[model samples]
Target: MIIDLARFVEKERPYWQELEKALDEIRARLLDLSDLKQSRRVLGLFQRACSDLARVGQANAEPELRNYLETLVARGYSEIHSSQTYVRRFRPLHWFLRTLPRTFRRQMWAFNLSVALTLIGMLVGGILLVADPDGRQVALAPFPHVAHQTPSQRVADEETANNDKQKMLEERKSSFSAQLMANNIGVSIKAMAFGLTWGIGTALLLFYNGVILGAVCLDYMLDGQTVFLLGWLLPHGSFEIPAILIGGQAGFVLARALIGWGTRDGMRTRLRMIVPDLATLIGGVALMLVWAGIIEAFFSQYHAPVLPYWLKITFGSIELVILVAFYWYCGRKTGPEEEAEQ
Candidate 1:
């Protein structure tokens, strides 16, 4: 029996070990049974164990047994701990939010490109607006039309501007915190979606936004309203532009992932690996949008002529610092995990 057991262990170690454990337990139980019955039960148990060991040995002798073992091990691990199962259960949106900053950081090149492009767009737009024949009309379109002017009319106009500003402030007070978050998230999603079109769509989206900004700046410059434009745009553009650039970065990442999907191991395998990265990118965009909305709703409407430039500069600088720090922290946190996975 000892020799047979040794042979079974050599031929089928996994099955032999399991059978040995069961036999040990049966041996312990048999101590309580009558001698005849214990002998009969021991024989039956030995026969069953031998059958199990033979079945496993035959299976292992088949071609591709290594592959089969790997599959079995993976399946067993998945059944026990279910790491892959848990990842599957994970909601994309939730993952997108959680990993957003890391995704944005990974796409820093694209973000920088978007920033440069946005600045160029603003410059070009400003020039176009300045050269436009109806520059004043275009710039002041946000205001209402009125032909005649009186002392009372001027006061009324001033009051209306104050009222608009106040209303904007109230709205900001109510929703400023959430707006930036929502806007950042939306922009990131848009970037990712556009990336599906092979990044051309993303480029166009960036260009269109750039053109709009440039036209607005040009209009202000042409009207000799440089100071006004600077005051208005500086407060919010500081945060907003960076947020948008981050969005562009997300788009670039998505495009890159999509393009690289099938050139190596095939699409399914690549996508499984990249799912986490994709989530990170989406989260980054969401964060940017939230910041953008806050700036737009709260800081953009400040029209005080006497507001200090230093104050604006200081606040903007601080916000930029915070944003940079956030990305840095996220990078440190997720970078190693991603690298290890790679």
Candidate 2:
């Protein structure tokens, strides 16, 4: 049977056009080809284009039609074969702005639960301190100097005069910042690693952190320095807290995989599946903690009292807003590939 080359070209032109459009969108960064649906479509289109190129050759189609099919197939092939990861294009910035938020949003349930657990610990610690002042020592165990003395007593002591305090703070600023950064990183790494224990360690860490914070707040409140403490903690804690919570969420992801006992997928397979999201969470937490360390060491202590209390609080609030906006709105826009995937 003689093949109707002219009729075939006419019929398949739409498919060729679709393939070209898909390629254009993907190359232009309008589409996210990572979504399974969109990725499948792209592959299918590329295959069809390849088949059409072969058909044109077999039919001995006119030069114009053959060249058109050849070009379409070439473009589709290049795009489909090239690296498709979001990181392949924009690198770190892309991961931070788009991938981090997307991963966080996907694991919001774990995050919310972590937050709830932390809040409970804070409340319990605060209530215990109020109910029995002796419990303050337990709550403030993490802070040696502040644990034994009231904030007022510490402020008024001869050895800890304002000038001496300022001098000591200024001298230790760099070391303190480094220490804080190291501690934050340690906490995050532990929170992620402890998922091997089925999340018990992570949960305990979150609670302990909250209790520490609550006890510190109680210390300041009893000394009538609530505003002062807020100024000190809010600036860095705004970022630090979220980073820690994200770590907790990451741990939960691993814990979930480990507990996949009844599921069709084995624990190891589940672990591999969540590797991308876990990496993103851990990386984002590290970046946030770095920023927190800077603010805590250099800015928070200096500005907490120098700036008006209201202004400091406002700045912290603004930072919190920025964090929320970054996670909620960043990378929400769908490119052509993403839209097709949906």
Candidate 3:
């Protein structure tokens, strides 16, 4: 090893510099080493540098060379592995705005599957309601408020319940919002937690929710209250529905860990892998439901004049568009930027 210390240093310098650059890029958020290729390459570079450092030490090489190698190898180890789990003080704002979106994109397959299943459930519910009028009773049974009355009847009652309405709104909005948040969050948690059943329970719960949603919409549409239904549901449903679906996404993620189809990792390893993702998804869902619950209690409950259908519908549409943009584009790095990191 001591025979050609100068040549060894020259040969290893490029690799050490490359590893340092990769570390810098990661710190700058330009690259992600969660990818197999990047991790492998980085790990290779780190190991090589470590070997070089050991050889330098054995040969009693220059102190500066040994120290440089030591530092480079340590930084490589930290950055390469840190891609999976950042070790720092918790920053709520950064985690919510950045980490959460990146995690969602990383696990998009589960979310897309969740959406597809819910859509199928909605289609099935709509068809069942149209084919057999007798099934209407069973379909809407879960929501007695809608099940017991025609859409027109409920609309008229809500629009005309003007006796001390402001007083009632002032009194009930806070508590109502709280109740809605608690109930919706409970449902979402159950959706995620039920993944312990190998995703079957999560799927069933999502399907049931989709069925209820579809049935309620069809009931209102058939009864000629489409505007009223949109005014009431869209404002909150836009956020609430997607939030619930994300909960289901988290559940499927849990289920995937249990199944471990593609990866060769063991059960504990697989489970550990998705644990952070589950936490992120569930946390994001909680934030969404908080907004949804507020809208549902204050704005969605009031009919035209107090809160016009057009305004509520427009507001909800805007929220939906922003939400779609958030999940689709937020925290995403461009191909070139990511390449530069590598």
Best by lDDT: 3
lDDT of 1 by residue, 96-195 (tens): 4335555666557777766776677666556555676564345334443321332234334533576565776676664665755665566656866787
Q: Please identify model 2 stretches exceeding 4 Å from their true place.
A: 1-90, 154-161, 261-263, 303-305, 340-342
**What's the TM-score of each model vs. the native?**
0.57, 0.70, 0.73
RMSD values for the candidates in order, in angstroms, are: 12.1, 9.9, 9.2
The TM-score between candidate 2 and the true structure equals: 0.70
User: Tens digit of lDDT per residue, candidate 3, span 138-207?
Assistant: 7888888888888999998888887687688879899999999999999999999999899999999999
lDDT of the candidates, in the order given: 0.57, 0.83, 0.87
Give the clashing residue pairs of candidate 2, or none.
30-335, 30-336, 31-335, 31-336, 31-337, 32-337, 32-338
What TM-score does candidate 1 get on C-alpha atoms? 0.57
* Worst lDDT 10-window in candidate 3: 80-89
Worst 10 residues of 1 by lDDT: 143-152
Candidate scoring better on TM-score of 2 and 3: 3
The alpha-carbon lDDT assigned to residue 32 of candidate 1 equals 26
